[model samples]
Target: MHIVVCMKQVPDSAQIRVHPVTNTIMRQGVPTIINPYDLFALEEAMRLRDRFGGEVTVLTMGPPMAEDSLRKALTFGADRAVLLTDRFFAGSDTLATSYALAGALAKIGEEFGKPSIVFTGKQTIDGDTAQVGPGIAKRLRLNQLTYVARIAELDLAAEEITVERRAEGGVQVLSTRLPVLVTMLEGTNEMRRGTLEDAFRAARTQVVTWSAADAGITDLTKCGLRGSPTIVKKVFAPSARAEKAHQIPTADLSFEALAEAVMGEIFARQPAIEGDLMRFSSGQ
Candidate 1:
């Protein structure tokens, strides 16, 4: 029961800034952290490994700096970590990113034992596209379950898994066999703090770093920006609105008077809202 958890390192959204001239993200001075959503996936994977008695391997594709994220996963009790970094993988879009990740996964399977399940977050904060997980599953021809709320059961001998998937209307209970890819939803579980022993082990463990060639990626054309068809013509922040919030003074007013004043202000701003409230009160 080998489980593979895929994660990414992204700039802290609170500290991210846009370049004024270039209209691009300013990564030079921004601090980086593991994608917040991916922490849920990592926690789920670790939980599964703990219950089923197996090794969990964390994998990522990014610049050399991404090694920090992998080591962090090791501290959370992952058995191993793999980093896929290469110059050819620069400026990769979701398609190219998924292609590279799928190729690396193939190599990981060959080097270690084949993973029964591959897990990832629903989306990345940087891209916010939520496409890479499904893309990887498509390229690898694996059954994909996205937005999974909970894993109900796993039968190792039977090689089957059951999960409760979140949908637009409600939750859907689905069952699938092994060798599947799952994108976990946020809030599934909380990430655990590393013990002193685990922290020491992570500090000494060497991360397995691989180039594109090492991951068995044969086609260079399908790797980086060249393989990406989507082009960003511009990136800029939206302008702030000119309107300022109006405050109501309640110090001198009674509770009823304050309520009336608040309602008057609301009606003044949007007259149609009063009519809607009246119709609802009348049960129209």
Candidate 2:
């Protein structure tokens, strides 16, 4: 079984700054890290590889400096790393990004046998759109499973997979075939720390770097900003709110008392909510 994990390098959200005049993100001097959500995907892929006795290849599309994140993934036991960077891929929105990524994935399959499963994060911190994963799946004509909480089973011989997907109100159990794309939810598994030997191997490994042409991406018009139709009219931070939290005091710290005190505060703020809760509890 070959598992492909899609990852991204993004500016640390904690230290990200918005330009005062331009109202755009100020990336200069900002440190970069693997998209936090993608870590869960990587960890899940590694776990699957460990159990199935296969390889996990991590792929990312970003600038040349983004190679740092790919190397970091190797330290976490990914069998290989590929970086897709190109001038034509600059300023790509989710649409163009997915297109380029899908193309690169095709090239990867040509070099390393076609992957049985592809894993991606629930969302990226920078984009927060959560569209790229589905977009890639759509372009590649692969079955897509999003917000997957658990992978129940995998039948390599039968080429089938079962997973529990988190939906709006409850979980949805789904069974699908191989060559599927999964967007893994966060906190499903913990990322492993690399051993000294693994770190050394990662330091020496040369990441496979490819440009748009190298990845067999034709039609330059469909890449970068040229292919993206979405327009960003403005990018600004929300105004700071002045509201503060209200504390509810409880005597003796008893569970019942604390619960009642918290409910009392909620009722005090929204009297209608209390009546609604009572009616619902009484099945009205």
Which number leads on TM-score?
1
TM-score for every candidate vs. truth?
0.92, 0.85
RMSD of 1: 2.2
Candidate 1 colliding pairs:
none
Instruction: Quote the positional error of residue 215 for candidate 1 in Å.
Output: 0.7
Please give the RMSD of candidate 2 to the true structure.
4.4
Per-residue lDDT of candidate 2, residues 1-284 (tens digit): 88999999999999988888787888999999999999999999988888998889999999999999999999988989999999999999999999999999999999997999999999999889999999999999889999999999999999999999999999999999988999999989899998888899898888999999899999888899999998777767788778867766656789988998888888998999988998999995
Question: What's model 2's TM-score?
Answer: 0.85
Q: Please provide, for model 1 over 108-215, each residue's C-alpha lDDT reduced to its tens digit, 9 standing for 90 to 100.
A: 999998999999999989889999999999998889999999999999999999999999999999999988999999999999998889899999999999999999
What 10-residue stretch in candidate 1 is worst by lDDT? Answer: 231-240
